[model samples]
Target chain A: MASACWGLPDAFCQFPAMDGKSLLLMRRTIDGTFRDIVRSWSGAIDAATAPLQIALNALERAFTSTPWIVVLALVLAIVWAGSRSWRIVAGTAVAMLAIGWFGLWRDTMVTLAMVSVCTAMAVVIGLPIGIAAARSDRMQRVINPVLDVMQTLPSFVYLIPVVVIFGIGKVPGMIAVVIYAVPPMIRLTNLGIRLVDAQVLEAAEAFGSSGRQKLWNVQLPLALPALMTGVNQTIMMALSMVVVASMVGVGGLGKNVLQAINNQFFTLGFLNGFALVAIAIIFDRTSQAFGQRLQQYRGAAHD
Target chain B: MTDQSVPTLEDEDEVATRPGLEIRGLYKIFGPSPSRWIGAVKAGMTKTDLNRRHGHVLGLTDISLSIPPGRITVIMGLSGSGKSTLIRHINGLIAPTAGEILFDGTDVCRMSAAELRGFRRSRTAMVFQKFALLPHRTVLENTRYGLDIRGVPRAEAERAARRWIARVGLGGYENSYPSQLSGGMQQRVGLARALATDAEILLMDEAFSALDPLIRLDMQRILLELQEELHRTIVFITHDLDEALRLGDRIAILRDGRLEQVGTGQDIVLRPANDYIAAFVHEVNRARVIRLSAVATPLAETEEAPRLALPDRLVLEEAAREMLAAGAERALVVGPRRRPLGIVRIGDLLAGMVRPSGRPPTDQAPTGPRGKP
Candidate 1:
């Protein structure tokens, strides 16, 4: 089959006689563009390195060689502030300190920053698109199939497109993180808008509301709780992407875990993964709790 | 036929001040078929018989009635009787199949889109059975929503809404969302919204039916108060005859997409034009419905009559109350200008305890002694 395709092109070249020169020119242009693309990738990498180094320095200053007692105390303060359970807080503090005693805090902080940045970008881009999709049937028709493909395609498949578009850097990793995390917000927004009561819509119409007025006054406010749930899901998904994204040069606890796997350091890899899970749990709980609060306020206000 | 049965206006004030709304030969037909086939089928059947055979599902048909200004005309019917469909036609929510709806002598069916919209915003307003209050808005906001659509400034519209809300007896519920209010309260919000527009005609379709019984009574009283104060021409649709009787100055009874009769509440109850109408009034308490006119016999001359004075048009019960109060054996029935018409005695009341039929006097024995009116 390969030989057959090559023969067809070669036959065309023979027939045209000028096809050879055109093909040569096409190849040259392709090569020039590829070089330009490579140079641009290198420049972006150089620019991105400063931020990465600065982040690493911050992590290093915050966690590296810090006394286990102080780190434990900070952990206790966080756990106490969040859960408010003294025994659980004490246990968490001891556990975090033990991980730091094993020298894993710097790696955990790097993982935290990568997940935070990825989650933030995903929310900023995904939310407006989700809102647009909710309001428009045409937008939904265009977006739904794209979201289906994004969700069902293998996790590793996202890396190929991101690598081609962004080249090997933290930005490519960020792209992969965004792709993996965006579908939930879109789906949730669609569901929320669809779930608004028909009687409520009729009431708005009876009030002489214009289309825009109805959407802003009734639809968006009612959908806020569901949108918050989508945000929470997006954050969890971004956090889940952290480990896989590190393969494209997103250095973090994910990188440490990968190195530990390579070096047969079982305890170090397990600890880094544990820290990732903890951060994911914390974000997930906080967002879900906030969504519930929003629901309560909306219900009381509506009544 | 000319309405020879309608008595001349006793007082000039009793005549309609304005020709409120006039509808002419309204027709609404659904489904698409060649007219040749429909005409062929319809040719063989009278409309009522056709409706009976088909189960009468197409809402309004050939409805023509006028609502006089400052009068409450109740359109009474069971479910699927086209009352709601008829009201919807006035605001152009549902266009008539073929009709001329004249709003203060202007044809509504001929209005341009912009004109129709302005007409709806300014000339006519409606309250629905479901209250149809915008759920997200406060009572005040919902009340002002129509005014807002009409381009009234925010503060002015809201100020107007506040007054109307109080007028509808929804006084302190200004900032509360619909979900926070009871069904009756929500309906009051709807009433306020419609009234705030200052539309001359108010169309209420089963407006109080959704409320609890006690609340329904309360709302009905409030509605009567509003009607009294404003004297707006109101077209109230309800299945409940009691509600119709309590509120309507004139009542139009509809059955199976047609108007059976249009008359005063007393006229319908005491003098139904047909058997279907008779059945509607069958359960009504005759004592409640009978006025002095129903049993009154015109007084005789030649110095042989008892001296008592009564108007011929009052209900029999009301006449009886007067007879008992005045301790008279017979009451004199007077014509419009207080001319001596006849007499109504307690014996005449006893003799009238039989069914009223439109057939000649030969069908039953004489009620006491009949005399000319």
Candidate 2:
């Protein structure tokens, strides 16, 4: 009986409150229902059609993409230059080229660019705050909470507010990457400065070092190893943010993979996924190798 | 660096040196609140009483001492005996709650920050237990650090540091980092740094303790050689009695923040001031702390000099070693000028070693300053 009353025909309830308006009001009510039905139908159609367009786009980009062999050659050059070893260079080259041949280079570069921008922003913004944190306890206290929030917030949840503010775009996606990548640098800097031996500080002071002199001469140099670790972690985190960023219009390997999944294209999805891993490995190894080189040079200089 | 030349032995003798550094009735009471009311309420309280009434740590108290010029004065104590704190007071690393620390004629506690900085930069150098070399700097750069702080030209400081590094036996290792050197070598760098400052006083806080046993002995020998040349008044802090005996011209023992005793090595070892002191020295090898002059009697016959001569300041153990090495029955005990004052017979040394009493019992030993129990 309640369903019957609630579902009564629209014509009975469309009577106007004033004279000569009932018929027009009834007709308008009928039109409103019909418009709602059409909108619903169109929304479903758009949702269904949107993913197909994305796949077609991904497919076109993948074919015209930088060839796997060419990208492999570039990677080989970098690895050989860095390590002076043909075997390691060749190995890296082969891995990257295989991912590319399997059709993943376009998505891979998208992830690469995202990681690059995020890491750059993190370094630019975090280095000074880290310096300040090292200098003052008050600044450290202020930065600590922000760092805590960035570190503890769920990865998926990072997009909610970013999406609201920037409205889904590469900028918002890049911002998300920065938010995830910055905490490590700030924390490592503060810890490195704090961990510097007190006796060293005394020696510096005895030598007549002013506050700034001590920071530059003693604190910063000693803290370099730890800070490099922070940089490495920040880069790794930005890479991890690639897939998360794609949820907000970040069209990259992550988006391509997402399109492949929606279309049930197993080979396409696997290729993109493997390429993402390969890119991550390449960056991780390179950054770590660079850090090792830095350590060796700095260690020798100190010696 | 000081404008004046380093003093020779003769000049040091003529200085009429009273106390290069004096701590008069020093006190450091660590409490949450530094209020007169709280201090008064806790006055005359025992450690337990203080702990009950207010959580406090008495790091130092009534630490009256005088480190004489051109002599090595060691403040010896175990951990928590306030030896480190006491030394820190000399340079105002920690300020005393109630007392005066007079460095030369100037009151250290009263100095303004700028004045303190000037004094510290130009006049005093400290060697920590850890070598504390800046890990980033080369040995030469580390040594130059103090001079650089003093506004010396970089070239001049580098030159000075290079000279000091060579002096400390690290001539070729100047460009090496602290990490690249052995512990002993690192300490050599620290010593070079302290010496390069050309400070009037050198404060060493167990500077050799971190080295291996063999390295420590080598460093100790090196220090004696340096002292013979430098003649700087040194205040060395250590818990090792043997080290204290070996290096200290005068030794002060601290217990629970109080000055238990202060005397020359012979005085402290032969006649400890109290039970607390006696307990501390009880197990110490007496053959190490006592000196030849301490147990030796003046020569009965002035006609002939003793067959052998030994410094009056050498430990009885060293005397015994000398006697054994030389196969001599006795050695002449000499004053600072190498003048024969007495003789140390092997029999006398053996007798001294036999009865290595912790404290001189009542009515049997000299009493006053350090001998009293």
Candidate 3:
């Protein structure tokens, strides 16, 4: 039924009433008989969602409960480590501090935690699927349409099913964000591995590299830049989901921004919106910079 | 004909004469279902007819050659001529649609996955056209990759790789990545990598094609020098005739999925098997290819020539120069250990050097009628 939740709204949105039931029956059987399918997960949802719910809650609390100074220093240190750019690190520090001054610091951390967890989960799940799709034609054919649907589906559409299953919390909100962010990683990873030089692969085969050996030693190393780009896009996509997902009781910087819209307070909306943008800019610039470094390293390696 | 000699520890020299690799009745058809067209192809259907009727491209058709041991067998052809396809079959990179690739006496096509792995790791190594070095790895790492795949201990593989790197004249650049090297240097890394594996057979598929001409020549000389001592069975693929002539003890020419001719370099140039082959050989510098023994008169009872003993394998150009310098009409063409094999007259050398002047053959000629497009 956790799976059925998404199928219900998908069917509801497509036909509402117009289409026939062969497709309907197919959907029904797939998600378990359609009649009470939505309700089937009510009992099981709590247990099934427990581990993830707890994990995300702890993550959100960890970020929000930390003293402002320690979080700021830790983040700046990471940014510096990755890019080795004092300017960028300084910029990130200023941006994070500005959010604190705007009284949106706690909410900002929650949003960051949500985005981080979802994007991590997306990559963790998507990368293997991408590798599988790259390796086998049959798997690619099967994964292609599923990815197409996943990518093209509106970010808001999956929220309905997520809300039904996880019942309007950090967990469901994360599910929505992950579903939105995952496709790019999958597509780019598949494309990257597929685009690896044919002759290089032949060289590996000529050297008697086992399939696993070839993937690890040759394919993955060369695919790093493109995979990093995929990661960048996934991070951006997850960030974009914050505002929409907050409607499902996801308390964060998004919820603050939502309230600004509801209350029609110009200053509130502007400040909170600015905070969101700052966070986005921090992640986006860092990821893109890291990706550029990877590209540069890769360029040195190519003909 | 085969020696069929059993291995005796006493005669290590006999091992060098046994055939290292053999391709028998090889056919490769490219399409959705190649098996459907294999029968028609084996019965001698034209490549065009097969493609028109079945949409299957004929890549290689009935390629058979006995590649002699410890010598270079150059498979030469223009692009789309299946030379690449033929080289690939040697190391089992491409499985023939139907044929047996006999390595030593065993059929490579019949090898199981494990056996194929063992064969590739222990018997054959390859150099690629584009110098396919792993970009991220340093030159030393790239050189050690073949041995690494064979599960050689890191220290020993690195030691062997270092020696090969220096042999290819890339001694100090071991720590640099492949990207840091020039084309010639990169190819050196590629060559070192292949050689470091210590495989008995080396498959070089246009390995020097991408290098500048001077560098290409340098690499050819390097390979020749190395082969002098190593005696590895090398299957070298090339589109360039001169390179083929210089390197090949035996040359097999292919055109559009069919074997045009297979013979020694002199046999190819002096007596081409067909008109198409005649055209391929026509523009080639024949004096550089024709061996003295190829044009030599048998040692007869008529006249005792000046005692200018030359190796039977000296090319016509070199022999011509030697003969003209000595002001002699003929010279002794000596076999192994100076046993007189035959006599080569200067006139025979001059006759073989003349360019073939004639029309191209019109019957069953491959690619098209006039030979040259």
Candidate 1 per-residue lDDT, tens place, B1-373, comes to 1142234343325436555788887766444432322343334444554346554334566678877877788999999788878877777766776778997778888887667777877777778888867665789998997798778999999999999998887889898888788788889898999899888788888989888889998988888777745778899999998788777778888887788788777667655666777778777766645545656764455646667777654556677788899998887776444555667789776544444645424443222111101
Docking quality (DockQ) of candidate 2: 0.25
| Preferred candidate (lDDT higher): 2 or 3 | 3
Model 1 quality (TM-score): 0.65
Candidate 3: regions farther than 4 A off? A1-35, A295-297, A301-303, B1-14, B17-19, B292-314, B318-352, B355-373
**TM-score to native of every candidate shown:** 0.65, 0.77, 0.86
What is model 3's DockQ versus the real complex?
0.44
**Candidate 2 residue lDDT tens string, B95-115:** 777789888789998998788
Instruction: Please give the DockQ score of every candidate, comma-separated.
Output: 0.16, 0.25, 0.44
TM-score of chain B of 3: 0.84
lDDT of each: 0.72, 0.77, 0.84
Q: In angstroms, how far off is A100's CA in candidate 2? A: 5.1
Q: In angstroms, how far off is B116's CA in candidate 1?
A: 5.3
Q: Give the interface-residue alpha carbon RMSD of model 2.
A: 3.2
TM-score of 3: 0.86
A best-first ranking of the candidates according to their TM-score comes to 3, 2, 1
Residue B201 shift from truth in candidate 1, angstroms = 3.5
